[model samples]
Target: MCVISGTHGVEGFCGSGAQIALLEDAAVIAAVEKYGVAVMFYHALNPYGFSYCARTNEDNIDLNRNFRDFSRPLPVNAAYREVHDFMVPSTWPPTPENEARIGAYLSTRGEAALQAAVSGGQCDCADGLFYGGAAPAWSNGVFRDMLRRHAASRRRFAWIDFHTGLGPYGHAEKIHSGPNDAAMIARARAWYGIDVTSFHDGSSTSAVLTGVNYEAPLEECPGVECTGIALEYGTLSLLETLQALRGDAWLRNHPDADAKTRAAIKRRCRDAFYCDADDWKAMVYDQARDACLQAITQLAAAPVPH
Candidate 1:
C-alpha cells in the first residue's frame, strides 16, 4: 500500500513526484505483479488543500491530524488556543504591530511552544489551519472503507507513506508506525535495517502521531500481518518551513489583504514543502524508488506470517 504525505498538492514536489516515479518504474511494477501484492495508491488525500496550496483541506483539517475516533472526546492541545488568532489574523498581511506581537510571543514562549501551538492538531476552530477535525475526515473514511474491502483477502500488507520538509534536502528518514510491537519492529529492521526510528523515542520528525491509518488496520485486520513506514524526505529547515506556514495561515485568514501579499504568502508555503527544480525532483524520486523496491523484495522473500 502507498501512503504518501505531502499529498496536499503544494507539497507535490516532494513525495508526489517520487510516488509517480515508483508507479512507473518497470522493476517495481514487475515486483508487485510477481508478489501478487495489490497496489493501493492514495493520491492527494487532501485534494482541497493540495489544489489550493494550503496544508489543511477545505475543511481546514490536516488529513494526518484528523484521524481520531470521533466517538471519544478529541485530543485537546490547550496551547493552540492562545496562538490561533495570531496564526490566522483577522487582517491580511498582518499589520507590522501584529508581526511584532507574534515575534515577541515566540521569544517569550520559545520555539517549542510555537511548534506545539501550530502543529498540535485542534478541533475548536474550522477556519484555523492544522485543525484536526471534530470528526472523521472524508479521506479517513475513504481509506477505512478501502481497507475493509481489500484487507480481507490479503494476509500480508506493507505500507510506505511519502512525506517531505524534514531532514536535509533529498535525504529520507524511515519512521516506523504504531506501538513498538517487537515482532513488527523486527520485520521492519530486517527490511530497512537499524535506522528505523519511532515516535516514542523522540527521534522521528513526526510529532507523537495517532489515528487509524496505522492503528486501525492493526485492530480491524487482525487476520493480516501489517507493517508501515512514513518515508520523510528533506526539503527545507524546520524554522523556515514554520515561518512559511505561519505566513500562509496569516494570508488565508486575511482575504481582504493585497493581491501581492497573498501571492507571496502562497509561494512561501509551496516552497516550504516542495522542491520545484528538476534536479531535486530526480533525487527524491530515485530514493523513493529504492525504498519501495526494497520493501517489495523483503515482502516477497519473507515467509507468510502466521
Candidate 2:
C-alpha cells in the first residue's frame, strides 16, 4: 500500500501514476473490492524532498535509510565512507581541486565503484543530506502504524514502491524484494509478471542496501506474507544523477553559497530526475498507471498460496 515516490525530490514525476491513474483504474478498483483487498496508499513518503528537489527528507535523512533503531547501534555504510567527502563537498560544485580529485577517483576506482560508494546512504553526518537518522523518523512511525492497522487481519501483502533514475530511460525495472522466501518470490513474479529481478541474483538494477521502506513491513507483519517491488523508471544516466546529488548536497551544506548558484544546482538536480517535457510526462504517467493497475489486479485477485 506504500506507493513510495519522492525518495529523491525530482523523482516526483514517478508519483503521478500512484496518485492519479492507478487509483482510477477500473480493473484495479474492481479487483480490490471484489477480493476484499484493503489498501493504504502512502504517497510521497518524503514530501519535503519532493518539494525541495532533494532526495532526503526535511531532517536531511534519506527516508529509505532512516527506518532502523537509531538509539542503540546505527548501521554503518562502509562504502559511503569512502566517497562521503566528494558527495557533500565542503565547497561549491566541482572546484578545480574537487574536479581533479573526482577525476582521479573515477579513473582509479571506475564508474560503478564511484556510484556504489556515493549513492549508498550514510550516517555520522547530520549536516550533510541523505544522512540516515539516528532513530525512526515520523514517516517511519506512520508507516509502521499503518501497516499494523491495515495488515493485522490479512494473511498476505504486496507493495510496489515507484522510483526513477536508473536503467534505460522510460523503462520500468521491476526490482524484487530483499527477502528470499520461495513463496514470496513466486507471488512477486505472478503479480509483476516474469520480468522482475532479485538483488540476490545480481540481475536487478537496484544496488544492494539496508533499511529500505520495504523491509519494515516484512519485519512488522510477520503473520502476513509480504512481498515488495520497486517500479524503477529511468530518466538519466547514473553519473548525471549522482552529479546532481553531489551539487545539491553541496549547496545544502554550504549556506554561504550564493542564491544564483543554489538555484542553478537545484535546477540541474530536478532536471536530472524529472522530465519536464509534456510528452515525457505523459509517457511516465501512462506507464505508471498501467503498472499500478496490473499490480492491484494481481494482488487483489490472486488466491493465497498454500
Candidate 3:
C-alpha cells in the first residue's frame, strides 16, 4: 500500500499533515503491519512548490498534469483557451474590466463548463491555468521510479493519494483512478465503501483530469493489479477555490509584488485547500486512517500472484 500527499504543491499541506499524523498513530501502524501490508508514504512530491506555496513546480508546470505520454499528441483545452487571457491578466487581482470579462464567461458557460475548461489539464498555453508540461516533469519521473522499485514485486497494490479543494467542507470523496471495469469498480466500492466515485462516469466532484499521478503504477508495474483512489477532502467552496488558484497564478506571474500582496494570496490559497479548524483536521485524519485500513485489509485478503 502507498499513500501520496502534496502532489500539487500548495494544495498538499493538509495531506502532508495527515500523512504525518497517520505515521505517528501507533494503532494505525500496528494495524497495517498486522495485515502484512508494506506502506509507503510520499510526502511533498513537488518540494519546490510545497516550500514556495506555489501550485506549479519550478518550471511552472502543474505537477499533477505533467504525467503524460509525451510521444503522443497532448490533450487540448479549447474552453480554457477561450478564457486564458482573462484568467491570467498582466495585472495582479485583474482589472475591473478583465474581472468582468471572466465573470461574463463564467455566467455564460456555467460552472461545470468553466471547471472543465480550466481544470481539465491543458497541453497548450504553458503560461495559462492547468498547463500540462511538454515533457515529463521531475516529480513524474520520480514517482514512476518509485513505483518501479517498490511496487513491481507486489501482486496486488492499493494506493490512496490525498488531495483537497473539491467537495463539501471536510467531506472526503474517494475517487477511483484505474480501469473502470465492473470488477474494479466493485472492488473499490467494497474497500472504500459506496461513497467512492469515478471520473469516467462524471460522478466525482472533480472534472475528468488527464495525466493524473495514479496512472504511474499502470505504466511502471503492468503485471500488478493496481487499484488507486484519490481521497479529495474539501475545505472551501468551488468558486473560492478557483479564485485562489487564479490568485496564485497571478502571483507566480508577478514575483516582484509587495509582501502584503504575497501574504494575502498565500493565505487565500491555504484557506481554499485547507480548513484551519481542529474539527477539520480531525476529519482528515479519521478519513485517511479509515481508507488506509480498508485498503490494507482488502489487499491482505487477496491471493498473492506467482
Candidate 4:
C-alpha cells in the first residue's frame, strides 16, 4: 500500500492528520500485519509548500501538475491562454471588470469550460495557476527515485493520494489517479468501489489534467498491477477556493505588498484548503481510515499475486 500526503502542499493539513491517525491506529497496524502489506507513507512530498503554507514549491510550481515525460511536446492549454490574463490578473482582489469577464465567459462558455481552461495543465504561463513546469522538477525526480527503490518490484500496488479543496465538505471523492487505461481504472473501481470517478471519462469533479505525478509510478514500476486514487475532500466552494488561490498566486508574484494584505491572503489560502474544525477532522480521518482498510482488504484478497 502506497499512501501519499501533501502533493498539493497546503492540502497536507488534512492529509497529514489522516496519515498520523493511520500510523497510530491499532486496527491499521493489525491489518498491515495480517495482509503482510508493505506500506510506504510519503509525507510532505512537496515539503516547501507544506512548510510555507503555500500550494507550490519555492519556484511556484504546482507539484501535482509538475510530473510528466518532459522529453515529449507539452500539452497546450489554448483556453488557459485565452483566460490567463483575467484568471491570474494584473492585480489582487481582481477588478470588477476582471470578475465580470469571468462571469461572462462562464455564462457563455459554461462553468465546466472555464474550469477546464483555468485548471487543466498549462506550461506557457510560468506564474499562472496549474502551470505544468517546462521540465521535471527536483521533487519529481525524488519521487521517481522513491518509487524505483520501494515499488519497482511490487507485484500488486495500491495507492491513495490525499487531497483537499474540492467536492462537498467532508466527502471523500475517490478520483481514479492513474491514466485512462481501462484495466487500471477498472482495478481502481473494483478495489475502491464504483464511486471512484475518472477525469478521463468526465465523471470526476476535477478537470482532465495532464502532467500528473502518477506517470512516475507507471514508468518506474513497469508491469506492476497498480490501482491508484486521490481521496479529495471539500473545504470551500469552488469560487471561494479559486479566489483564495488567485490571491496566493498574486502574493507570490508581489512580495512587496503590504503586511496586512499579505496576512489576509495567507489566511484565506489556508482556509480554502484546510478546515480547522473537529467535525471536519473526524470526518476526514474516518473516511481515510475506511479507504485504507478497503485497499488492505483487496490486497489481502488478491487470488494470485503477480
**Best-to-worst TM-score order:** 4, 3, 2, 1
**For all candidates, what are the clash counts?**
4, 1, 0, 0
Winner by TM-score between candidate 4 and candidate 1: 4
| Tens digit per residue, CA lDDT, model 3, 156-221 | 988888888899889899999775567788778888899899988888988988888867888889
RMSD of 2: 2.3
Instruction: Order the numbered candidates by lDDT, best leading.
Output: 4, 3, 1, 2
Clashes of 3: 0
Q: Per-residue lDDT of 202-239 in model 4, one digit per residue for the tens?
A: 99999999888888888899888778899999999888
Best candidate, lDDT: 4
Best by TM-score: 4
Clashing pairs in 2: 70-134
Which residue runs does candidate 1 get wrong by more than 4 Å? 3-7, 105-109, 180-182, 256-258
Q: So what's the TM-score on candidate 4?
A: 0.97
Give the least accurate 10-residue stretch of model 3, judged by summed lDDT.
177-186
lDDT winner between 3 and 4, please give it: 4
RMSD of each: 2.5, 2.3, 1.3, 1.1
The global C-alpha lDDT for each of the candidates, from Candidate 1 onward, is 0.74, 0.73, 0.86, 0.89
